[model samples]
Target: MTPWILLPRRVVSFRMPILRQAFALQALHELGRLAPDLARVRAQRSLEASLQSLREACLTTLGMELDTLTLFDARSVVRLFAHAEQARILAHLMDERARTLAEHGDYVGALSDTVYAGQLLACSRQRFGVQRDAGAAEALERELPKPGP
Candidate 1:
């Protein structure tokens, strides 16, 4: 009689073009969440290169465009790899923007952006199921140290 042996099989997961685009968007969003202030500060120049790289990677790998994937739609994806430090950075940046606007006498704009920032921070926390940390919204508010009169 001959002895039989079993071999393990490897499985591969395939990602579609749309899915790749979604992933890229999620990456960008997370980058924003990680360093919101840096993102805003270098919004035009810095991120462009990385954004272009993602675009090219998607196009070459999956043949798709990045714009079709919206940030809201990418929320769940972003949460999967959320980094607490980055999220905190983003919160701080948003708070800074709000403060700057207020100081410039643009109360309405300041309030609006501040609210938006808060919403983003909340979404990140809720989605990632992360406990509020030192860099969270509360910390951001206190540390912002808004300019005085």
Candidate 2:
């Protein structure tokens, strides 16, 4: 599979599986940027495993178990229209994964996951007309470090 960074920015699709992969790639890219030397090497290995799970989710009909929940359900009734709820669930999973990464000293990966979680949440709201939750994306915005001087 092509590495996420090599994929063109405009190539990302609205499809749920594709979006999940794209976000995963983006988070991995950020991990490369922000993690320290030893941590970056360790995180690359860890995140690669996560990416493989995401790849399997994209390719298979069966759901993949992730952190106590299955993020993909190809048979769901809602998938007939759009994967809005799926996206929301994946966003929640991303947040949880971020915490896990942070606990393992992959803070850059955690930040990237949180930011993309917010993006995925916002995308779900806009695309499927899901009602906005007041507490959702705002905290992610707060977590983003301000621009450097």
Per-model root-mean-square deviation over C-alphas: 10.5, 17.3
Task: Locate the minimum summed-lDDT window of 10 residues in model 2.
Answer: 72-81
lDDT of 1 at 132: 47
TM-score of each: 0.39, 0.38
Candidate closest to the true structure, highest TM-score: 1
Tens-digit per-residue lDDT, 38-144, candidate 1:
33443444434534543443333223343332234334433543354334444344455565556556799679757765665666777645664433444444433
Q: For model 1, which pairs clash?
A: 33-86, 34-86
Inter-residue clash pairs, candidate 2: none
lDDT of 2: 0.48
Q: Model 1, residue 109: what's the lDDT?
A: 66
